[model samples]
Target: MAFFGIFALIPLVGVVYFSMVKWNGMGTPQWVGFDNWSASLTDKTTLNAIKLSLIVMVVTWGVQTPISLLLGVFMAGRQRYRAVLSVLYFLPLLFSSAAIGIIFKSMVDPNFGLFSHIPVRWLQQSYLSPTLALPTVMFVITWAFVPFHSLLYQAGVRQIPQTMYEAAMIDGASPWKQFWSITIPQLKYTIVTSSTLQLVGALTYFDLFYVMTQGGPGDATRILPLHMYITGFKSFDYGRSAVISVILAVVGLTLSLTLNKLSGTGKMESQQEGI
Candidate 1:
């Protein structure tokens, strides 16, 4: 509790206060009311950042969810061959995200990347260009994050009582039917938990964009987090950056709270804690 207050709670309070002030990276913060917030709201770049952030959030969740869930369910099987395959699939999880971004950035470079060496004409096109940068970023995010989410789903699938599958089979349920009725239903809570984390985490995904595209090819990949970073660090408008941060925090908290409300998981967690 003490740590939470000193770190998370206190910093959050400071951020809120800072959002209303006028300050560069240095010098004292001068309280300027909601001027910073107003400026952030009116900025064209900020709007683009917000739009890109939402698009990234939606596309990431959409692409990652089905693939992760399916891979997880498949890996949960007790097949001998899957042991090797599962390890291969999880290789991405072992690398740091920054390293993954760096490696891929090199791999996709137009002149020197792996794709440039390949004979394929389409694959060699400039991937980080304005026309293709957003898609490229989305693809990289999916590649990097799907394994972790699948691991969550795998654990959830394994926890399902084997007897349920057995009973379904005895009732003449086909494999697909068993999966639909048994597997999906059993993994509901896990889905909620995974989704809340994925969506919220997407809002704060800065490092990969920092190292990969650098919100580059002319702001094609500059989501809100990157925009905030550029504002704070590059532009040195700490106050306006704090406004963006507050906006991100508000959106993330609203998403989390809404998911918790819809899933009823918060009540369950509270009840379990009492026991």
Candidate 2:
């Protein structure tokens, strides 16, 4: 906690303070009060970035969570196959974002790439087209993060007593019924935790977009993190960048707390104790 306070908390406090002033990094900061906040709130690019970030978050949750839950449920019942497949699924997590971005970039390149021979050139144009860029990045982000969430769900499934399944089986519960009644409810905490992580990640997503699209085909994939980076480094508008940071922190904290409450994660320990 001490280390976290010194590193994370202190920097966040600095960011909040800096958000109220205009600074170009090398020059003296000018007190701008709420001007940066006002400008950022009304800025078209910032609004677009927020919109794209929300789209990515929705797509990620829609695509990644269900798939992870399904895979986790399937793998939980198969010990031998699970051992092999878990490694395969987790291999993506071992690679750095830059490496994965570069490899995928190559795979989608217009010439001498795997997707180059496709009739429609969908892969080549995915990051280059304004209509497709955000969705394409969302898909890539989902692919990268699914395995981690799957592992979480798998761990949750393992914690569930096998005797409950046996009891359900003897009581004539079909596999699908067991899944709906048992699996889904039992994995509630895992779902909440994974969804929170994915939401926060998608909101602040940057590296893949930086490597793959650089927030282009005209700012289609410019998430808040990328927007913050551009505002700070590229444009030298540190105040506005800090404003984006504070917004991200507040948004992330709000969503995490809301999901925790909705899923009853905060009550889990007390419920278990009562039992």
lDDT (tens digit, per residue) of candidate 1 on 1-275: 89877888877888866754433422326767777777889999999999999999899999999999999999998998887889999999888878888888888999999998899888889988998988887898889988888998999999999999999989999999999999999999999888887888889788788888889878899999999899889988888887787788789878888888999877322100000
Best model per TM-score: 1
Q: Residue 244 of candidate 1: its Cα lDDT?
A: 82
Candidate 2 lDDT by residue in tens digits, 180-240: 9999999988888777777766766677889988888778778888999998889988888
Stretch of 10 with least lDDT, candidate 2: 266-275
- Which residue runs of candidate 1 sit more than 4 Å off their true CA positions? 1-28, 267-275
Q: For model 2, what is the error of residue 171's alpha carbon versus the real structure, in angstroms, after optimal superposition? A: 1.6
lDDT of each: 0.85, 0.78
Deviation in angstroms for 34 in model 1?
A: 1.3
Per-candidate TM-score against the hidden true structure:
0.87, 0.84
**Clash count list over all predictions:** 0, 0
Residue 22 error for model 2, in Å? 11
Question: What residue pairs are clashing in model 2?
Answer: none
